[model samples]
Target: MKLPRSIEEIRSDFPILSVKVHDKPLIYLDNGATTQKPVQVLQVMDELYRTANANVHRGVHYLSDIVSERYEAARETVRAFINAPKREEVIFTAGTTASINAVAFSFGERFVHEGDEIIISGMEHHANIVPWQMLCERKGSKLRIIPFSDQGVLDLEAYRSMFTERTRIVAVTHASNVLGTINPVKEIVTEAHRHDVPVLIDGAQSIQHGIVDVADIGCDFFAFSGHKIYGPNGIGVLYGKEKWLNEIPPYQGGGDMVASVTFEKTTYNELPFKFEAGTTNFTGAIGLGTALDYLTALGREAVAEREQALLAQATGGLSSVSGMRIYGTAPGKVSLVSFLPGNIHPYDAGMILDKMGIAVRTGTHCAQPVMDRYGITGTIRASMAFYNTEEEIDALVKGVRKVTEMFA
Candidate 1:
């Protein structure tokens, strides 16, 4: 079967392309931060606001029933998207950070004892790193970091050596947002399981890349954000193994998370509801469902092929430029290229590209330890999605060349 040659049809659905920044066509390459929403996702949210706007699982009225039905359907969609075991295993939170915090606060408190060790990789974003640090501090546990090699791959030998009886949890990113390195998560999870340690994978970057199945990966927990996957902001998912979910305590206390309350004691709700406490992002959930549907319709094989082609073209073109140093030269990477131009700050490079209406992220990318490992402050990151075009990449190369010439 033949797939679409170019993503032009998909790109046309985003209305933001009409806007001009500096009388130049906008070239959006900051997809690692967040993706532009398609018309279908926007329309889904609009339809909810116009017709079925109501709080879910609270009211018995007609609109409430409709909203609640859609919300629950969204959970099913997420379950299918990740190939999770059941709908109840999916918990909705604000984003990846909130989901990780839920696990840290609930599971950490219950499972982690003093002198126990929590292992994480050095390539983790602050969202993944800080929560475990805080959890370890509170529990009087120690945080162990698995260092990366000079080529940007995780030090597997070091990671395996770090595992011991006291290692309660192992949390790491499936794909590094800054480095674009896709970690061998299946191997990591399997190795951790051999030591009787649970593993959590931060899928914030991997969810949009291609296919992901928690059961297939054998991860105890997986987390991702909606906005990064073309859905609305303030919505995300946490997928936990049923056994693990059953063991963890409630993350927060409030309306829906409780079964019965008394002056003396309280009984909590089951599985997912025990984690989701307050008013949730009903519209965002509906939007995320629509986004997943759109992506599924496109097919993961096709998305992966197109994005890999784009990455090859972009990386090849950038390598031809003088004084361009690309970071994250690992053998297998996603559709992102981080680089530094000789004698130019990443912020200055980003500023120059911004004048040409090119949008790219330039900073530590919330992975300070990775930056420190590379012995650099930061790199200008150009992350692409399947909807991006070759013409856009050409424009980016031209802009970077111009910046280099001017700065030189």
Candidate 2:
């Protein structure tokens, strides 16, 4: 597949593209951290605040009604985005961290027991790993890790062997934020189901790459962040099967989450509302809906193709640089390419890149366990998005080469 010659049109939609850093045009490659929002998403949030700002599900006035309608519409949009079976299966949270925590707190409390096991892969972000650890610690359950091979791919045989009747949950990342390895979630979920273990997929990195079908994967829970998919921050989604969601207890208590609260007892609301508590991020959710729409209009297949080609170009270009060591050389990876230059700290390299107006992330990327597994401190990560262009990749290559020349 041919790389996009010019992403000028798509880049124009993001106002931040015009930003100047160090007297040079910004070359943003820190997409894995959080993506630049499109004009459409910003406009949607602006419109919501201007015309439809009000508390949802409680007000009867015109503005309140409109706000409530838009808020619910955003939930529906998220439902379709992940191809979730029912709208009630979609629950909004602060971000992937909170979403995962909700599942850990509610489902973990009910299902987990002493001597039970929760399986996680070595490449999991702290959001996915720490919650399960806490749950296991609280419940006297054991936490098992699925080790990865030297090439950064999960060891399937080892993973299969880890499953047993005692395995209560299998939580893994759909894609590694640091390594860019796209996991075989469908296979993992199927294997876990054979033993009747629930699976939760952290999709913070995968959602922007291509379409994510919760039904197809058959996982019990899927979590992703809005900001990583070109939406506003402080908004995310947790998709669970209707049956599973119905079974899990409420994570929080608040006004909207309760159907009736009396002096003695209270009843929780239905499906999603039972979990969602307090005033939500209304404008951020609206922005998330707009972001999903923007990505849908661009088409998933096209976005995937473009990003894969860019990954190929980036890997190929960087391979030739002397003294440069790239991590996550696994096949079927995503748009991220992480590496370390000889005798150079990733933070120092990141500072040098910033001087050249190339923004990239450096460090453990919230996957400190993965770093510990590999015996490395950290890496320099350049993650891509659909709106990025070949020129940006070229700039990244040039910047790396310059860094290598100076350090190596």
Candidate 3:
């Protein structure tokens, strides 16, 4: 069978792309939940475990020096990947969840006051919502929501109106996981800055789609997971402005985060180390670095354009389906489609698609507020990466149609 030339070339780099489900060819379209790992990232992790394994930043041995050097170099790669101002501004976390939780505790402890409000959007993933809720409950602060329209675009005017003297911070998703709505985060940041409030962008869904310049966005903090960008799990990044990192307290207490420890008091380490507590996922960090390297080599702009074509093809094909109610028809969006067809439950559709070796996510997608806003239990979401092809999208459309017919 002849495949599309570009994606065929790109797909070979990912070993899992060839996987089969139920004795049928696997058509992996669940990039939003977590992207598939590339062989390049896996090989880097494997090489580390094989020959150069050692605890980083701890010992004077040769292996320690080697591993520590590679680990810090990986931090520098991430620093450049997002165009962060300094390496010290990059802090490794378990994933996006842990990164947001870090800011919730540390940023909240330092800046938030009772009766103060923090702004977020209705389209945010639960990772963005629950952390602030916890922070609000702990501090007696309030959570203010910037509502979206039926099309899943944030009401920018409502957003501006929501701010008040008591509004201390704004947390938002750069792209909605379920909706694929690419937010105007730079504009959001500029608006927040006028009120002297800092904004944190959850970049879990946005980063893999294209380049994300924290410097360009001017967001105070950004968080994303490695797995969302073809890297290993158990690794994520928190990119904070230097001022915020300096002002916020440590999120956890453990080794390496301290400069010195006394029985009475302890002086914490500075900048990135101050926020990073305990032995982190060192191998995973290396794997993330390799993934970033892969992206860099491929050039994010080229990858983005490829995915855009896939998005257009998928959207056009899926729209032709009868009774399809596609969500988040923003003029600008990443490569994903979320929809419900003709009173069909998303779970039922997803199960049928799976038997045909098509992987899709169904239900709330961890953004229950979005579902509540639309009065939907969930949606069947197919998120694509640059490696996917027009053929795969055609397959997805066919699968959805089959499900609809099956139900009919």
| Model 2 local distance difference test score | 0.90
Q: Arrange candidates by TM-score, highest first: which order? A: 1, 3, 2
Best by lDDT: 3
Q: Report the poorest 10 consecutive residues by lDDT, candidate 2.
A: 1-10
Q: What's the TM-score of every candidate structure?
A: 0.98, 0.98, 0.98
Write down the RMSD of candidate 2 (Cα, Å): 1.5
Name model 3 segments beyond 4 Å from true: 1-5
lDDT of 2 by residue, 204-259 (tens): 99999988899999999999999999999999999988888889888889979999
How many residue pairs clash (N, CA or C atoms closer than 3 angstroms) in each of the candidate models, in the order given? Answer: 0, 0, 0
Pairs with steric clashes in candidate 1: none
Expressed as tens digits, the lDDT of each residue in 1-408 for candidate 1 is: 234544676788888865789898899999999999999999999999999998988999999999999999999999999999999999989999999999998899899999999999999999999999999889999999999887789999999999888999999999999889999999999999999999999999999989999999999999999999989999999999999999989878998888999989999988778888988898999899999988888887788778888899989988888988998888888899999888799999999999999999999999999999988999999999888889999999999999999899
State the TM-score for model 3: 0.98
RMSD of 3: 2.1
lDDT, residue 85, model 1: 92
